[model samples]
Target: MTDLECRLLVIGGGPGGYVCASRAARMGVDTILVEAGRLGGTCLNIGCIPSKALIHVAALFDTARRQAAGGMQGISVAEPVLDFAAAQEDCAEKVATLRAGVGGLMERSGVKVVQGHAWFRDGKSVEVESETGTLLVRAENVVIATGARPVELPGLPFGGKVLDSAGALALTELPERLAVVGAGYIGLELGTAFARLGSAVTIIEAAARILPQYDDSLTRPVRRRLGDFGIALELNSNVTDWQAREGRLTFQSDGAEQVLETDAVLVTVGRLPNLDGLGVGELALRMTDGFIEIDEHCRTSMRGVYAIGDVTPGEMLAHRAMAQGEIVADIVAGHANGWDRTCVPAVCFTDPEIAVVGLLPGEPSEETVVSQFAFRANGRAVTLGDTEGFVRILARKRDHVILGIQAVGPGVSELVSGFALAIEAGLRVEDIAATIHAHPTLSEALLEAALMQASMANHG
Candidate 1:
């Protein structure tokens, strides 16, 4: 057994863990990061990065297919053939390149990367079972950045034809008829990609509508686009059973039983915090809703121990984890910091992307004025030939201080940062209205929405 010591030890080499370790180490704190898998964790290895790459490929193929069917804007092309294996290989290459970049960043930042599975020996000590031998690490401060895993359905377990988001990304061959058993972002994203790639995709959602977290208005365009892509949606449905031998999935919907003959089923209902086999039980750490509870500074109940990322509360997003990691790193490096950010933006890369930040419509507010600017009216969107959605801004009725901003349109994901910045800067509707946004750009829609809220819309 080899024993080591550090001022800071991060238990998972994900976005949160690696960020915390590297940032702290650069600040002159001795830090060590341990992981059982790739350095980038789920987001890089199997989740966000690979998924987006697949989505991009799907979009390209879809555009080509459309052009072949009938030329768009005088652009014509032959019916595109999809090489699934090559697409997968490209995604793999992207992940590997990013993974290597992350490793380089850690090395340059002076973070020691230990490849192993680590478990708590005590509050300040951890024992890692590495391939070479048993290694023990003692640290003054520890951050639990162990991320979450995909939640599986009760009856239809993951394996064989049943796949989680990770398993779906690693598929050797795309299923001809795919049944995705969730309507959340993950399900919709993958389902849309497969459909674009020529798979007959059916999305089954237990909720009443797709993207149940968002309001009907924001998701309506997405729903319409799904139909345009020839994908089926089964809302308000519950999967009862799956027969592997018969390739049949049984579900109950609206007091009726239905069956779907699918080549494979991808279940992505949700994700649970990954706390299994970590021996956290021995530490007796406090947990809330099955996740490690932490304060604004990401400090857990245990002294010198902290938690971040999906293992803790808040949205399970890579950017959120990175922000929290920055705060923890600053605090550990003898500076003072806490979570005081105004909002965390969320983006869904659907047919028409959805991006939102700050408060929604129904959230507790004192007399809010909601205003919207349709992309159809925006010159840039009209020129782009995809004007199917709108941007809505919610603000305080009296002061017009922007409370929330929600958008559903083409490439709205790129506009989210500016929306977040506006809220963080406490910009009122008047402020956005007065700002000069570039003409013939999607960002002009934000200004126009604010102008509408301010009752001075120029191009609404």
Candidate 2:
């Protein structure tokens, strides 16, 4: 067995792990990163990047179909056909290129990249089992960034016609009738993509509403779009069991035990941290709700050990993980920084995307000022023929301190920076209202919302 020693060792080479390793190595600290699978982990391989690419393709298809149906001048085409194999190949190519780039970065930084399954031997040491043999790694500090996996239900396990987000991304053929088992962000994103690509998609959710975490006003536009697409929604529904027969799957729904015929079932209930095989319990690490508990500096309960990303998370987002990774690297380098940010944005890439920052749960304060402006009033939205959403702002009624910003509209993901900046800088509603916004733009809604917050009758 080979013995390895480093100043910093990061377990699991996902966004969090790779970023921590890269940053520390660049600072001339001896760093080593180990991964059992691809370098980019789930995000690049199966989650965010690939799924967004598919969503973009679906949007383009829908746009083209709408234009053809309207008989718009000079736009002529036959029925749009989806080449699933080509789309999958395109996604794979992009992921491979990114993975190779990550590998190259580690090599250039002199950070050792080990390919194996890592299990903790103790607080400061870990054993990696590789194809050749077991390798021992000892480090002064260790960071666990193993990330998460999709949760599997008891009665309907992943197999044959039933698949998870990862398996769904690898599919080459489109299922004629598809049933998505959850209405969370992942399920809606993938289900919408497939629906736009000509699948009769049905969404089954146990909750009374889709996107229960988001306010009703914010989700109204997306619900309307889903209706326009003929995507059936079964709310407050429970799946009892699923069986595959004759190359098709049938599932039993709640109340009367109705059967639904489906070519494939995509289960996206939620994700849980991948901590089972790491031998963490053996180290006596404190865990809460299946996640490792860590302090602001990403330090675990045990000394010389740290955890970040989805494994020890507030929000399981790639950007959040990246931020935590950078913070941990700084702390490791003796910079004395901790993971503290006022705003971490959450985005959902649906037909009409949703972006939110600094939104808190609870009863609205009596001194809270809320304002909203619809896309129907924006010239740019109307010009794009996609005016079906709105932007809402919440602030302290007394001082107009901007507390939260939520938006649902086309291309709203690109607007998250503005919302985050407002919250981060403690900008008052009057400050945003006084700032002039360009006319004939969707961003005008932001200005209108700000004006409303100021109690000024600017745009009716």
Candidate 3:
């Protein structure tokens, strides 16, 4: 076995691991990152990037089909033929390009990238089994950024007809009938995309409503849009079994057994921390609710050991992990840093996308005021012929301090950063109202919402 030593070792070469290793190395710290797969992890390779590409392609095809059926806005087009194989190839190429970029960045940053599976030997030592041979790595500090994987159902395992999110995305041919076993963001996003791509999509949810995390107001628009796309929603339903041979899915809904004939079944219930086979049992790390516990600086219970991303507690988002990785790198490099961000924005890439940051209506202890601006009244949304949702702001009733901002509409994902900035900067409603917004733009909705909260709304 070969032996190596480093100042810092980051496990799992994902967004968090790579970021930590790259930042620490740039700061003159000896750093090494280990991974068994591609450099970009799930987010860059399979989860986020690939899913978004599929959604974009599906949307393009759906729009073209609509134009072909009935001309919209005086525009007509011939029926668009879908080349599923070509679309998959394009998506794979994009993922490859991004992965190569990540590899190049690591090489330039001087981070020693080890392509292997890392197993913990002790708090400060690890054994990596690569294709070539075994390599023993000893480091002063270790960061566990091993991400999570999709949670499988009890009776239905991931295989031929039954698939997980990753398997669904990796499909070469689109299924004619798709039955998604969850209504969360992952399920909804993929189900919506498949529906647009001409699948008879059916969403099954145990909860009473779709997107239980968001209130009714935000999810209403997406629900309406799903109906418009002819997607069937089976809320308050529980999956019981799946017969792969017959392609039959049985579920319990409203105290009755229901069976669905589908070509594929996608299970996206949730994600569990990928701690198995890592030999975490070798270390006495503190864990809460099956996740590694960490402080503001992402320091674990063991000295010089840190954890970030899905392996640790908090939102399982690429940006959140990136932020934690930066703070941990700073602290490891003798620079003082901690997790002090006010809020982490969340986006649901559904039909009419949902973006939310900071407090909701009743999240604040003090009395709050809510202001809303519908997209139907926004010139840009109206002109685009896709005005289906609204922008809303919540603020302190007495001080007009903006507590939270959320929007559900076309391209709201791009607007969430501004919402996070507003909350992080402690900008009040009056501040947003005073700032001039360009006309004929979707952002004017933000100004209008703030103005309404300030009782000075110029537009409805």
Candidate 4:
């Protein structure tokens, strides 16, 4: 058995783990990062990046289809045909490129990359089973960034035509009819992509509305887009069972069990921490709901051990995990930084991409003024011929402090930085309204929303 020693040993080479390992190595800490699977983990290899690529392709195809339908001048083209094999190939290539980039980063940072499954021998020691042989690593600090996996439906067996998000992304054949379970961001984003790609998409949600976590006003634009796609939405519905026959999937819904012949069924319910075979119970670490409990500094209950990313708690966004990774690196380097931020932005790549920052879950205060500026009013949106949503701002009535900024429109994802900055800096509504946004642009809606809150409209 080979033996190795390091100052920091990171398990899982996902977003959080890789970032933490690289940062630690740069900070002069001897770091070793071990991964049982691909270096980029789920987000890069399967989840965020690949999904965004598919969304972009679908967006382009949809735009072309719209141009053909509208008979726009100088926009003549044959009906858009989706090459599912090409799309899957493109996703695979992007994942491979990103995986190589991550490997290069590890090498450049002087972080040793170990390919194996690591099991804890103690708080400061790990035993790994590698292809070459067994190896033991002794370290002063350990970071568990094992990340998460998709939650499987209990009764509905996932095989054949029934698939999870990862499997759904890998399909080379576009199903004529697609049934998606769960209406969360994952389901909506992919379902919208598939719908744009000419699949008859139906979303079944146990909740009363899609994106139940988001405010109704914020989700209104998405609902409208869903209608535009002719995508069936069965809200307040549950999937009792699913069976596959002759390359078709049949599912039962609530109340009257109507059957729809589906070429594929995509499941996007949720994700749970990936703690299988990690032997966390053997250590003195505490767990909350199957996730390792960690403090703001990312320290686990056991001394010299820490946890971050989806394996910990809070939001399961990739950026959140990256932020935690940075904080953990800082803490390991004896810095005083912690995971404390006023706002964390989230984006959904639906038809009218939804971006939100610093939004409180409940109703706005009575004194808190809220305002909206529709994309229909924006000259850029008019020129693009894709006016579908609006930008909304919420602020305190007393001090005019910005409470939250939310937008549902084309290219809203690119505008999220400004929203996050406004909330993070505690900027007043007037400050945003006073800023000179360029004329005839999508960003003008942001300025308009802010201006509307101040009871003044430069351009209504």
Cα RMSD to the true fold for all candidates: 0.8, 1.8, 0.8, 1.8
TM-score of each: 0.99, 0.96, 0.99, 0.96
| Backbone-clash count (model 4) | 0
Per-candidate clashes come to 0, 0, 0, 0
Ranking by lDDT: 3, 1, 4, 2
lDDT of each residue in 1-460, candidate 4, tens digit only: 9999998999999999999999989998899999999998899988999999999888888878877786564586777777889988988898899899999999999999999999988888899999999999999999999999988887666777788888888888888989999999999999999999899999988888899988898898899999898899988777766656654434455566666667888989999999998888779988889989988798989999999999987889888888999998888877788867888899998878999998653666457878888999899999988888989888888998998888998999999999999998999988998899998889999999888877687778
TM for candidate 3 is 0.99
lDDT of 4 at 71: 55
Q: lDDT for every model?
A: 0.93, 0.87, 0.94, 0.88
Instruction: Report the candidate with higher TM-score, 3 versus 4.
Output: 3
lDDT of 1 by residue, 9-95 (tens): 998988988999899999999999999999999999999999999999999999999999989878999888999999999999999
C-alpha lDDT of residue 389 in model 3: 95
Cα lDDT tens digits, model 3, 69-157, are: 98878889999999998999999999999999999999999999999999999998999999989999999999999999999899898
